[model samples]
Target: MKSDRPSHEDFPHFQTLNTRWMDNDLYGHINNVTYYAYFDTVVNRYLIDAGGLDIHSGPVIAYVVSSGCDYFRSAAYPQVLEIGLRVTKLGNSSVTYSLGVFAQGEEALLACGQFVHVFVDRARETPVPIPATLRAALEPLCAPG
Candidate 1:
């Protein structure tokens, strides 16, 4: 059952991640749970660095409302991975990010996934419109129709 995962070229942003020894399971491949961590890392790094998301002290913060992944192949410890990221949808208070994980320098995808984040007021935890600066930063990554 091979997954028709999206290719690396489908994404606009990329981050390289090195697999740790502990990431491997008894079968010698990286554990499935670790893939979710990679997804979270890339998304948060982009938000903090490019979108000016103040994780600690901001009027609004994004909370993950949903996430899912499809594995195409297995990856092992010590493999360098290129995590690809793109925005598939941008709504008033929610944004959906599509991601692909590939072996570094390879064209084939090892995994593909998506996660939805809903922005909300930090204090009240109520949904709020995405801030201007954050929206501006995410625009470039939006997938072309």
Candidate 2:
């Protein structure tokens, strides 16, 4: 938690998310688990909207192979969050999404995490090259060195 978190500008894509009442815990703040949900939301929303993924009946699908989060500050219900996203790694069949939760117009991170997804053949459940269309869509979000 001491290292510097990436700024909002570091992300190439973003999704505006509104925290809900159910997202809160008994302590009255959004639970740690909900941050993962936020991570999934922005990643998949970009995949479907920008990556042209067919979640319902496509021959290919993306599965979350790994995920993690680091909470820097607590987020609460009734808060509108800017879930910023970038790709730090893009492989033949997998991609790593770097994400951050931030208050609107804020550069400081509330939370940050990485979500990894492996593209696979739907029926065979075997790894497959990421689709051209999807790869193209993700290119812009891949941050440079």
Candidate 3:
């Protein structure tokens, strides 16, 4: 049966991560909170790699202002996970990402979420327009309206 949920084709970018034994909970599946960690890892990894983000000494920084996830299936340790990502909304200083988690080699979504990041002046912690380079990097990832 085809799922109405989002799929790998919906996203333009992909990042892969491996699950660790430590990620599992007593029930033997990945802990619920760990999904959020996967969300953060993929988003920031993209920012740093494609957006030219300077996590250490950049004038601008991104803060996680909002995020939420929905799980479709349980994933446990020993599975390689793939994150499919796209920008659902791109604003002056903030971006909303639609991220999907899938067991590697699987087409179905194991989980999906929207994660928000607001660019800010590193020192003042006030919102600032996303830098041209970073914004350019993000444009390709934005889903068409």
User: Tens digits of per-residue lDDT for model 3 on 33-110?
Assistant: 998999889989998999899999999999999989998999999999999999999999999999999999998889
lDDT of 1 by residue, 1-145 (tens): 7444566778999999999999999999999889989999999999999999999999999999999998889999899999999999999999999999999999988888899999999999999999999999999999988
Screening candidate 1 with a backbone cut-off below 3 angstroms (N, C-alpha, C), the clashing residue pairs are: none
Q: How many clashes would you count in candidate 3?
A: 0
lDDT of 1 at 124: 100
Ranking by TM-score: 3, 2, 1
Clashing pairs in 3: none
Using lDDT as the yardstick, the better of models 2 and 3 is 3
Task: Pick out the ten consecutive residues of candidate 2 with the lowest summed lDDT.
Answer: 1-10
Candidate 1 — what's its lDDT?
0.93
TM-score of every candidate: 0.95, 0.95, 0.96
Full ranking by lDDT: 1, 3, 2
